[model samples]
Target: MKQLIIITFFLMSSVVLVAQPTFDLGIKAGINNSKVTFRASEYNSESIVKAHFGAFGRLGWGRIYVQPEAYFSSKGGEVFEEGTPSERAGRFDYNNIDIPVLLGVKVINGGMANVRVMAGPVFSVMTSNKIDGNDLLNKQYYEDNYFGYQYGIGVDVSNFFIDARMEHGGELYKHPTLDIDGKNQTFMITVGFKIL
Candidate 1:
């Protein structure tokens, strides 16, 4: 990933001979239907309020382009522990901040709209380690410090954009048979702006 970013930077410096780098800023918000699972573990699904509101920029030279974005996002995972009649089950919630950089290839373009495919790594940090009035359950999970990878496509029409992508922690946990291997898979949609 470092190599890819470096190469892209050099390419952008040279590509500006025709058209200089251009940028756009916007805000995005959406719902996250998340699941913490594995090939072995039990199913734990959570739907929390997930959204991103920040600034994004695009650098383009004719049809070939690259977009880099930095944003603050409230991301979390939830699981239902146990339940009974007239009693609600416990919940697991984690809130985080996500920073993503995307590299894209434009397949088609129009005067008022454009379509591109993107893939990149998201660097995330845990901002809140406690959830649902409990601090013990969320500690070890929050200690994980690593970059997750995401890939998706985008459709930009005038000032509106829609994105769909998948993300994973890429590691297994210590819970063994109940270990959560597939962690933090987020499906999101947010409205953005083209503040050129």
Candidate 2:
């Protein structure tokens, strides 16, 4: 029994020493096409194109993983209203800090490449907002923080990855008197390289 116990302990230690660690750090850059949707109005805004860049850290154990990222993103859209013999149009702009935490699983691990599916919640804080060339920060007309979610599929090849995702904002602005209830929706594609 004593000899068996010693052998078991030795085997466990050897397994621990030989196992590989499952952590990676990466950098990513992407483009986003974003729009604002109103709940009760037909005045839909046009989609705006923007760029996003960020760094992410991923931790994985076998086929399951979690990835958290911090990035800079640009958002907002143009609103146009048709009036009598005329048209009133303006644009809204915003710069934001976006953070997303995603849980994922590797569905196919093919030696040099892998396929993954992920979904998670995102939190964003507006750094600056402008409408029709007027700053919303000084005007105090809108909120600064927002919540959203994203789901996507990704392909990883060695140290590089590509991801395509759809994201939607939960609540934008709601004013019953003004009839302004809107949310944001975005489509994005990103490419990344693992650094660690």
Clashes of each: 0, 0
TM-score of each: 0.71, 0.81
Per-residue CA lDDT of model 1 for 45-108, tens digit only, reads 4556556666677776666666666666555555543343212323455555677777887677
lDDT of each: 0.61, 0.81
Instruction: Score residue 60 of candidate 2 by CA lDDT.
Output: 82
The deviation in Å at residue 160 for candidate 2 is 0.9
RMSD of each: 7.6, 4.9
In model 2, how large is the Cα lDDT of residue 151? 96
Worst 10 residues of 1 by lDDT: 81-90
Off by over 4 Å in 2: 1-21, 82-87, 133-139
Best by lDDT: 2
